[model samples]
Target: MADVSDPLSLEWGGRPARGAPGPMLAALEPAAHRYRFQQGARRRSSVTYLDTVDRRLRKKGLSLRYESDSDSEVLVASAPDGIDTTELGEAPVWPALAEQLPAGSVADRVGPAMWVRAVAPVVETEVVSREITARNEDDKIVARLHWQEATANGSPTLARVSLDPLRGYAADAERIARLLADSGEFVVPERSLAEVWLRHAADDEVERRPTITAGMRADVAVATALLGFLDAIERNVAGTIDDVDTEFLHDLRVAVRRSRSVLKLTGDALPERLVARGARELKWLGDATTPTRDLDVYLLELDELATRLTVGTRADLDDFATHLHWERTVARRSLVRALQSKRFERWCESWRQSLTEIVSSGGSEQSGSVEELARDRVRVAYKRVLKRANAITPDCPGERVHSLRKRAKELRYLLEMFAPVCDRKPHRAVVKNLKRVQDILGAVQDGEVQSASLRVFAERMLDRRSASAATLLAMGELSAGFAGEQRQARDELTDALPGFLGSSVHKRVTAMLP
Candidate 1:
C-alpha cells in the first residue's frame, strides 16, 4: 500500500450533462518532449455504499462500498491533512476482516457495533472514469490521477479528480490539484458526496430529547421535553408495527416509559386530567410490548445461556430453545396486532394532540415557576428514596430493594429534567449517587425476573412433555444461580444504602436545587 499522505482529491460540479474529463486532463498534459501521458480507456460502473442504519461508518470518516461488477468491497478511510488509506476485501460483507484490518488503525473499528445490524446499500452512485499516469524520462511513474464523473442517486452529476503523488513529489500533486481546480468553473463543494447521498436517502427524522434552556418557564420547558419523547413514540409506531428491526420496538418502549416518567416527575405542574390520561395509555403500550420484548431478550441470549451449561448438558437445552422460539412467534404476533389496531392509533393521536395543547396552553392554575417546581419535586423525591432506603434491613426481601429502585429512578428523572436549571456540579453529584442505588437495585430485580421466568418456562416444557428431564435439570440449575445472584445484589444494595441516603448525598441534593 502507498503512503496515505501522497494522495489528494479535488472535487467540483459541472452541468449534469456537459463535461468531458479529456479536456480537463488535456489542460494538465505536458508537451510530448518534456513528459509522457498515458490515458486508459474510460470505464463506467456503479458503486453501492454499505453502512448501519445509524450511519456509524460514515460518521467515522470512512466510505465502505462494493463497486458494480466487482467481487470485492473497499473501505476508504480519510484522516486530517489529506491522508487516507483504502483497504479492499474479497468478501462483500467484510465485518470479520475489517475487525482485524491494519491493527490499531481506524480500519479495525466498527465490527462490534455492527452486531445485530444488517449492512445494506444505503446509497448508490454511477461513475465514468479513466486513470492517467505521468511518467518521467526514465519511465518511472512520477504521479497518477483518477479523473471521473459521479452521479449520486437523484442528484446532479459532478466531476472529480483524485491525485496520487509518488514519494518526494508532493509539489507535483499540488500543481495537479491547481490544474484540476482551474478547469472550467471548478470549485470546492460545501458538502461531501456522502453528505449529499445521505441527505437524499435519509428516512424520517429520528427524535432526540430536547435540552431545556435555562430560565425558561417551568411548565413550558417540561412540556417541551415531554413532547420530544412523544414525537419519538409517534415516529416509531410504523417501524415497530412493521417489524423493521428490534431497535424500533425498543426505542418505542423507551419513549413511552420516558413520557410516563416526565408526567410523574412534574406532578401537578401538568394538568391532573392530562397526566392521568397519558399515564393510563402509556401503561397500556408498555404492557402490550412486554411479552414480545422479554421473548426477544431470551432469544438473543440463547447461545450465551447455552454456554452456561457443560458441553454435554448444553445439548439438553435444544428443546428449551425451540420452546422460546415458539413463544416469541406468539408474542410478536400479538404485539404486531396491538400496534396495528385502531385503538392503538386513536390512543397515540389523542396523546400527541392533548400534549401539544397542554404545552401551548395559557397560564393555568397548576403551573408554577420551573425553578420552584424543580426544587419541590427534587426534595420530595429525594426524601422518598431516603425513607425507603432506611426501611430496608439486611434480611429484607428483594422486593423491598426493587421498590426503592423505582423511587430512585423517579428521583433520577427529576434531577435530569431540572439539570439545566440547577447548580451543575451538585446536580451531577446527586445524580451519581442515585445511579449507584439504581444499578444495584436493577441487578437484583433482573435476577428475580429471570429466575422466575426460567422456572415458569421449565414447568411449561415439562407439562408439554416436550423436553427431556435433563433440560428441566439444567433449567433448575440456572434458576438457582440467578436466585443466588439476586441475593448477592440485595446484599450489595444493603451495604451501599448508607452512602446513597447519607448526609453527604443529602447535602448534594439540597445544594442542587434552586
Candidate 2:
C-alpha cells in the first residue's frame, strides 16, 4: 500500500496560447541537462468520480474514479494506500451497492466506509489528455507536462496544463513550479476538478438542521426548526417517489420523524390549530411511508443475513430475496401514490407559507425566550428518562424496556436540539453517554421487530407457495439469529443503565442544560 500525499504536478487554470511554448516551462533553467519538449502519448477517456451520500470518501482525504477507454476499464483510487488500481470486467453502474461490485482490493477499501448507503457517480468528466515529456541531455525523463481539456454538462470547460514531477528531481519540479507562479497569465486553483464538478452537480444542498439560540424567541425557534425539516421532507419527495435509491426514502422519513419530535416537545409555543393540523398530517405521512422503508432495510441486509444461516446454503434463500423484492415493489407503489396525492402537495405548500409567515412576523409576543422554555423542558425530559430507567427490572417484559427507550429518545432529541445553549464539554460528554445506551436499546428493538416480521414473512411465503421447505427452514435460522441478538442486547442494556442515568451523568446533564 502506497500513501502518496503530494500532488504530482503544479496545475494552472487555463490552457496556453496555441502554437507557442507555454509560459512556465519556457522559463525552466535546467542545471546540467539540455531540455527536450516532445509529445509523448495521447488518449481520450471517460472519467467519473464517486462518493457516498455524505461525501464519506472525500472527507477521509481519498478519491475514487472510474476511467475507461478502448483497452481497459479500471478503478483508480488516490487513497491512503498511495494510488491503487483495480481492474473491472466491465464498467460499474452508478448507485451500486458495495456488494454488487467484484470482491477485490478496491471493494475492500471502499465497502466499510460506505456501510449501507449506495455509492453513486458524483460527477462525470470527458477528458481529452496528451502527455509531453521534458527529457535531459542523457535522454532521461526528468519531467513531464500534461495538457487536458475536461468538460461536464452544465459546467464550464476545464482547460489546464500541469507539470508532472519526477522522483529524485525536487530541484527541477521546484524550478517549474516557481516559473508557473511568476507567470501572470496562469494561476493555481484551490479545488480540484472533481470537487468543482461535484459542487456544480449538487444544486439542491440545504442545511438539514436549524440554527437556534438560547435568547431567541421560543415560537421563532420552533418555527425555524420545523420549517427546515419541511424543506428536507419536500426536497426528498421526488427522489423517494421515483425510487432512485433507498436513502431518498430514508432521508424523507428522518425529516418526517424530526418534525414530529420537535412538535411533540415544543408545540406549545406555536399556534394551537396549526400545531394540531401539522401533527396530524405528518403522522399520516409517516404511516404511509413505513411499509416500504421496513422492506428496504430487510432487502439491503439480506445478503449479510443469509450468511448467518448455519443450516441452509445461501442459494436456498434465493426465493426469499425474490419475495422481498416483490414486496418492496408493491409497497413502493403505495408510497409513491401517497407522496403525489393532492392532499400531500397542498399540505406542503400550506405548511411552508404558514411557517414563513411566522418567521417573518418575529413570532407571537406571548411566547418567552427559548432559554427559559427549553430549560424547563430539558429538565423535565431528563427526569422522565431517569424515572423510566429506574422502573425497569431484568425480569420485566420487553414493554418496560420499550417504554424506557421512548423516554430516552425524547430526551436525546431535546438535548440535540438545545445543544447550542449548553456548555460544550459537558454537553458533548452527556450526549456521548446517552448515545452509548441508545445504541443497545435500538439494537434490541430492531432484533425484536425483525424477528417477528420474519416469521410473518415466512408464513406468507408458505401460504403462497413462494418459498421451498429449505428456504423456510433457512428463514427459521435467520429469525433465531435476530432473537439471539435481541436477548444479547437485553443483557447488555442491564449493564448500561447505571452508567447512563447514574449520579455522575445526572450531575453532568444538570450542569450542562440551559
Badly placed stretches (over 4 Å) of model 2 are 1-8, 11-48, 66-75, 84-93, 99-109, 121-132, 135-141, 147-161, 165-175, 178-210
Tens digit of per-residue lDDT, candidate 2, span 3-34: 22234444445453222345334433322234
Q: Report clash pairs, candidate 1.
A: 218-370
**Candidate 1 per-residue lDDT over residues 17-132, each given as its tens digit:** 22355575455553334446678767777776667656666666554555654433455443333334354545444322344344433343445445554445677788777787
TM-score computed on alpha carbons, candidate 2: 0.82
In order, candidate lDDTs are 0.70, 0.78
Best by lDDT: 2
lDDT of 1 at 506: 79
